[model samples]
Target: MTKTIVITGTSRGIGFELVKLFAAEGHTVFALSRNDKPVKGLNLDNVFTFSCDLNKASEVSEVAASIKSQVESVDVLINNAGQFLKQEFKDTKMEDVKSVYETNVFSVFDLTHKLLPLMKESTHVVTISSMGGVQGSMKFPGLAAYSSSKAAVITLTELLAEEYKENGPSFNVLALGAVQTEMLEEAFPGLEAPISALDMAEYIKDFSENGQRFYNGKLLQVSSSTP
Candidate 1:
């Protein structure tokens, strides 16, 4: 059976990899991102791409409506669109914090809420969190806003899992340590030795198929070193 999946932040990074993996496996993948340009070098014909700035609640809503109109249900939704802004507390601007929260937290929540009705029982909702969301990562400097937003997402995932455990979609947060993505390049110039997006995508594909049975409602960390 071919499942219909929706993946945000599909222009690049882990989300893009997920879109490719699922589509390659014969699933209908709705790839959403701000950039509507077609994915290059992908041979899968089961993928559909949409362009929308996920930071905007209205835009997120529109995307949800569009998906609902096209597909009766989405078997999986990967909320992978997020922003990371690194600035010292003293130098951080309020607008930047708001923007981070809007992109990383509020927009995801709004889209999830809007799409909840389109998910049937056993549907999977995966929110891509960061290791920074964990308790011990406070030592990382200049991550206050981004980390806090991810923490909120963790909480939201937990609540959603608990509230809908019986009859609604399952929710879980994948707290990744580090992956070789554009975000990592922007965060730490010249940094190396992170997990590859393809590997991470494969891990997520397996998790999406079975992790809920063992790790649903909990934060599962994934790193290059973890096997």
Candidate 2:
């Protein structure tokens, strides 16, 4: 059966790859992002793109209307949009922290809250997180704002899982390690990531469904190292 999957941050990276992966499988995919379209050379007719700034709550409402107009229910929801900043705590401004939370943490809540009615009983909510949020792990020095926002995501996922246990739709978090993508490159200039964005996207597509089937309120960390 063809599933309806909704993914955020489809402008690039893992989200872009996921749009292709799921659409090639003949699933109906809704790609949401600030950009008006998918990245160049990644366009697919199976994937419908919605342009909306997630940081703005009003835009999210408008997009929700657009989504509901087309699809009656969602099988999978991937909250993958995020903002990252590489700056020491002392150098990171409060505004940067607020911006990171706006995109990374709060936007997930806003969009998920609005889309809950469109999700069926078996819908899965997968939010991308980072290993930096893991306690006692390899906590990098310069990612205070980014890491904290990811931590908030993890906690929020847990809360949502429990909050909606009786209602419907499962919630899970994938706390990924550094993946080789533009976002990782921007944060750590020359360092190499053991996992590729394409590979992670493939894993996420399977895990989102499988995790929702067997697990709830769990945080699975994917990494090549302890971090």
Candidate 3:
């Protein structure tokens, strides 16, 4: 009953906690990140580490090839790696928008496309998004680029679901509220959040396991309140 799960962005935050959560459950986990070292104190036998910059096409392809060689099928692929930027639309640099999209949107698409061959019937593809991405939700002053990039991720998730649902691997995006993580602190310094990365990781664990049964091509907002 141990599923083979591939998770990206395990260097820290929710993705790091997810590696621990899945490995503790005895699932075979492939943890991908730019950092070469595994998370501190997580040396479980079931966790395999791969160091790759997801924004780099060659590195992503190489890592995908290596994973395909080792595992015939992957039960879940969690595209949790993302970048956030804080700048008003007028002041935002084009380079910042492109950079955020490269990591948050294009990288997710690239990795998922490469790993599609390894996914079978009923597999799950969950990508992390943000509450700001949800239309008509709370609006922020300096998150134009970051929010739009996440919006693209949700749209991409819908299209992928339509394209691949018949074969396997239902696609979904989790638009999350503020979580207490380094990323959050970077975006909004000194703000306390209702949820922590570890709490989000626990919710994502259950969602990754049972989401396809009730939801696919859906953007499920994970937040306790408007943030």
Candidate 4:
């Protein structure tokens, strides 16, 4: 069966890789991103692309409307869109914090709430979280806003999972560690030897397909040493 999948932030990074993987596997992939540029090398017939700034609630509503018109049920939803502002609490502007929350937390909640009605029983919803979400990192400086937002996402993921546990869909948060992506570069420049996006995508694909059965309602960590 060709499952209907929705993935956000498909313009680049792990989200882009995930869209390609799912689409190539013959699943219907609705790839959402701010940029509508053509994805090179994705020749799959099952892929559909949409441009929506996740920071705006109205744009999210528009995307939801379009999805409703075409797809009846979403088998999986990957909330992979996020923001990270690596500034100290004292130095971080209020606007930057608001923007981070809007991108990392608020938009995710809004989109999930709107599209959740379209999800059937046993549908899987995954959110890309960070290891920083689990415990506050004293080792790293200047990431208070980013880390806090991700922690909020982790909480939201757990709440949603419990809310839908008995009769509806499943939800899980993937707390990834040190993935070598543009976000990493933006957050921590000059850091070397992070996990590749392809490897991260493969891990995510496997988890989405099989790991969800056991790990639903849990925060699964993915790192270089994680098995």
Candidate 5:
């Protein structure tokens, strides 16, 4: 059974690895990233690479519309793209905070909203959040905008799951711990993570494909480190 999967932030890290993994498994994948070249460079037989800036609602809507026109139904949609702002709350500007939300919260809503028509009852929506976003978790310094925006999406996923529980398309959010990715390097320089990007992607790939059978509209804390 082949499935069509749509994933954002496909240019690098876990999203990039997931794209390749799914393509290798012979699934159709719509890969969205600001720089499409990375996935496009793969030239996978089943992948449709799109250059998209999630910060812009129009771009997210356009991508969803394009995907809607092509796929009969979306089996899974992964909101993997995120904006990280490593600034203290006192020093962070209003524009910086808005930019973070534009990608983390607003874009997730826009893409999911537009793509709902293409998702069937069995479809699964997986959103990638952060351990920092988890309430009462050990707070990190200089991530007020980024962490809060992630929290917003977590709530959004929960609400969407409840609203669609009677219908279909299970929604879930993953609060991830430290993973060795470019984003991690940027956020915490010289820090080593127990998990690699590929490792985490493998977990998410499996979860996106089968986790809905066991859980919906739930937040799963996926961290190897204490948070």
Candidate 6:
């Protein structure tokens, strides 16, 4: 069966790899990103690239409407778009924290809320989070804004899953560890991660396709390293 998967932040990293992986498997992928050029460059027939900034509520609504118009049903929604903030707690401004939340937290809610009508019981909503967000996980400094924002979505996933448990899509979150992506490089300069973007995407692709059967409303710690 060819699945219709909606992935955000498809310009690079795990989301970009996911677009290629799904398209190669003959799945229809709706790739949303600030810059569509990377996914567009591939020119895969199965992939549809949309230039979108999740932080913009209007853009999120418009993209959801566009997706609904194109696909009758969406099998998966991967909330992979996030804004990283690496300032110290004392130095982090309210505006900076809000900006991070705009992309990492609020946008996930906006896009998912709009597209949720097209989802079915069989559909899966996989949200990408960070290990820094996981409760009791090893914590790191200079990530107060980023980690707190991630935690918000983890709880939101649990709430949504329970709310829609009767006849709605499964909602789950993956609290990821260090992955060697540009985001990681930007966050922790010169630090190398054991997992690559493509490898993590592979795990997520498989999970998005089948993890719902075993889990829903659960936060899986997909990490091998500390914060």
What TM-score does structure 1 among the candidates reach?
A: 0.93
- lDDT score for residue 26 of model 3: 96
Q: What are the clashing pairs of model 2?
A: none
lDDT of 4 at 5: 89
User: What tens digits encode model 1's per-residue C-alpha lDDT throughout 116-185?
Assistant: 8899887889999888887665346788898899889999999989999888688999988778888887
True-structure RMSD for candidate 2: 1.4
RMSD in Å for all candidates: 2.1, 1.4, 1.2, 2.1, 0.9, 0.8
What TM-score, computed on C-alpha atoms, does each candidate reach?
Answer: 0.93, 0.96, 0.97, 0.93, 0.98, 0.98
Rank the candidate models, highest lDDT first. 6, 5, 3, 2, 4, 1
* Model 3, residue pairs in steric clash: none
Better of 4 and 6 by lDDT: 6
- On lDDT, the candidate that comes out on top is 6
**Model 5 C-alpha lDDT per residue in residues 1-227, reported as the tens digit of each score:** 99999999999999999999999999999999999999999988899999999988778878888998888899999999998899877898999899899989998898988899898999999999999999999888899999999899889999999999998989999999999999999998898999999999999999999999999999999999843
Candidate 5 residue 22 C-alpha distance from true site, Å = 0.3
Off by over 4 Å in 1: 38-44, 224-227
Question: lDDT of each model, Cα atoms only?
Answer: 0.83, 0.89, 0.91, 0.84, 0.93, 0.94
Query: Model 3 RMSD to the real structure?
Result: 1.2
Candidate 2 vs candidate 3, lDDT winner = 3
lDDT of 6 at 198: 98
The C-alpha local distance difference test score for the whole of candidate 3 amounts to 0.91
